[model samples]
Target: MELALVLPIFAIVLFALVEFTLLFYARADVVEASRIGARLATMPGITQQNVEAEVKKILPPQLGQGAVIKTEMGKHSGDVVMVAVSIPMTLASPNLLWPVGYNLKGQNLYSETRMIKE
Candidate 1:
């Protein structure tokens, strides 16, 4: 009886662990994309479109076009250029923990990177 009772709980925990692992991995990718975008933004004469393209390229394939990328350039040469990226996370599989209200879908993961203009 104990085996039957604990098996489902273990299975749910395993699924939840896998789901969170994928989400964290995706989050790391988003952070790297923002850093790359910020690096690109630091260069002079780079338009918003160019930065966005590079950022989208850096982002994981799962993100698709739902990502929002914003770039801001300061007036002076030595000023900061910031790149902000936001992506909505979708778990790899069905949320097994949803029965307990542990849904993690559709949550926006945001990353901002700032670099000084060259």
Candidate 2:
């Protein structure tokens, strides 16, 4: 009887831990994608369109669809180039014990980078 009572809670905690790990991985990927985009923007003659295309290519398929890329080019030489990437996160459903589903769902993961134009 005690085992049965504890199993549900244990399972829910495990599920939540796994879900959070996945979320962290996704967040890191998004940040890396943004950094890549910013680096590409720093290259000579690289347009915003090119940067966006490259960022999408670098991001995973699921994130690519929902990803938003924003680029800001420096007005003058030796200035800074900025790239921002945002991905919407949908949490795993049927969360039995934790409120993570409500807290994480529909939230956006974002990353931004700035580098000097080269």
Candidate 3:
């Protein structure tokens, strides 16, 4: 009887673990995408749209669709580029014990690099 009572709690914890793992993977993808975009943005003659396209291509299929990217040019007289990437993660269902659903937000990944214009 005690085992039966504990089984559901164990199952929910397991599900949450799986969700966290997925979120970590998505974070890695975001970092990779930001790096690629920053690199491309620094390249001479690379249009903003082209850089965005390259960055999108680097992300995983599911992430590419939902990913949001914002790029900013350096204000000073140097080649400093900034890229911010955000991805949303929605839970499959509400926790068996919680109200409606517990939404865990994905972290925003950002990368900044300075390069010599070629």
Q: Using lDDT as the measure, which candidate wins?
A: 1
Q: Return the TM-score for each candidate structure.
A: 0.89, 0.86, 0.75
Task: Identify the runs in model 3 with alpha carbons over 4 angstroms from their true place.
Answer: 74-77, 91-101, 105-118
The digit string of per-residue lDDT tens for model 1 on 1-118 reads 9999999889888988887887788888889999999998888888889999999998766674778888897667999999999887652334567777887577787899999998
lDDT (Cα, tens digit) per residue for candidate 2, span 1-118: 9999999778878887776777788888889999999998888888889999999999888778888899998766688999999887663222333454445556788899999998
Give per-candidate clash totals: 0, 0, 0
Clashing pairs in 3: none
Deviating ranges (above 4 Å) for candidate 1: 91-94
Better of 2 and 3 by lDDT: 2
Better of 1 and 3 by TM-score: 1
- Candidates in order have lDDT scores of 0.83, 0.82, 0.66
| Ranked candidates, highest TM-score first | 1, 2, 3
Show the colliding residue pairs in model 1: none
Residue 83 in candidate 1, Cα distance off native in Å: 0.6
Give residue 26's lDDT in candidate 1 (0 to 100).
Answer: 81
Clashes, model 2? 0
Which candidate comes out best when scored by TM-score? 1
In angstroms, give how far residue 52 of model 3 lies from its true place. Answer: 0.8
